[model samples]
Target: MSALDGLLLERVRGLWETVSGVPVTFPPPGSPAAIVTAPGSGLCPPAWVGIVSLGRSALVTAPDAAVARTLRQALSSVPDDALTCPDTVRSVLPVAEVLGPATLAYVTEGTFRPVPDEGDVEHLSVDDPAVSAFLEAAGPTDAEESGLAEVTSPVFVLRTRSGPPLLAAAGYRRWPCRTAHLCVLTAPERRGQGLARRVASAAVAHALTAGLLPQWRARPAASRRVARALGFREVGSQLSVRPELAHRPTGVTEGT
Candidate 1:
């Protein structure tokens, strides 16, 4: 399936490596890492205890006694903002979404395709000016900035081609062995237009063309509406948390 680009996914994998003092060893061939979000289980390797919190998680690739000792020490010495020790992770539970074969389709009407934003708006790809405007609107947070890269991030935006270009930003994580998780943004004034939906389609289309699946992971009700319009049916939801906002986990990570 189509997943995050080469660069953006490194940012995610790198976060765990940097904070946990362990290597993120991806599985080879037919069997890949399972999407681990829950407390008791996930897509973990035979010996690895894979923990994934909203903002941070501790991954121990080795499951032996020595590895367990290493993990304990790693946790103890980790800073308050460490991937597993962060305040936001403690408040939420594991993720739960309905699983199905990747079959998400596009909205059938003439409205949701990758049409340009319009005279005062332009719907361009990642390198286009419209996407640039959208990122400015998103205002990258502290951790996001730490991991941000121009070409690696799965960042996309919508820019109004009007006076003094404005934007809106959105983003998502790349699930291993699946598709490029989408993140989107747009100018506040650009709300209500189907431009967001269109931008999402464009991103998914890119993933599909690459022989990868584009998954719509987490989002709010408004954003979910866009997904519905784009032909994605809800199968399940995960317990989502924002360590960045409150320094601890607080909500359910929704999905499906």
Candidate 2:
């Protein structure tokens, strides 16, 4: 594998270790990398490189060899344009080959930094009655869902001092290798007020206290800014596709 290819493979391996709770060894030359886990490990698809690790010792499916080769080429040939959002994944894999419905996401990580002004954010218990209300108001987010499914702790949410309504919320899911996936969402009306950064900083602070590396996967410019302000650096990009579209052909357009 080329250097770029090795880097991409390492990215996925780190993610797998986080989610799998087992260290991922490099695949022998030309062999598929693998992981083993007990039930309830919470490995899922649409993660890095579109592979899922079942709790057992096997992968759900390996990438198509042709697709993998294409991706290797894409990673090796970075474009001159550096002013791109969601840069790395697209450089390595075309959307057309991703098929189904997919989204481009920016994956970032950083050493923890604490923000002094966290407002009146509370460490919400999972069973806190207000959590349901908050979710109802925030609508359904992948962050909230992941917290519900995989996190043992309550998510953190910023609330007004008097009324206790949510201004922003931050949560994380555990991964192997002392990593945590961080997510933050601010109320639509409360955006642009730096509320997101405050809550996210609090969450990152907590993750650091626990000795976990926080992973921030954001797609929006505003969210990316918040991540950067919290001292996170963009390390990679992720492409998430619906399972139904995983088998579709690339280089073909609709109505073609």
Best by lDDT: 2
Cα lDDT of model 2 by residue, 1-256, tens digit: 5564455346655565555434444344333324232233334343223433211112312233444344334433433222122334454444433421211222233334557963577888756766666667866664353254345445788877798677777777766566777767777788899888887777777777776667776566777778777777554343332222354357623330
Which candidate number would show the highest TM-score if scored against the true structure? 2
Question: Distance from true position, residue 187, model 2, in Å?
Answer: 1.1
* Residue 219 C-alpha lDDT in model 1: 37
Off by over 4 Å in 1: 1-133, 140-158, 163-174, 240-256
Query: C-alpha displacement of 209 in model 1, angstroms?
Result: 0.8
Task: Judge candidate 1 at residue 20 and give its lDDT.
Answer: 37
lDDT of 1 at 256: 20
Backbone clash count, each prediction separately = 43, 2
Q: Runs in model 2 with CA error above 4 Å? A: 1-13, 16-111, 141-150, 242-256
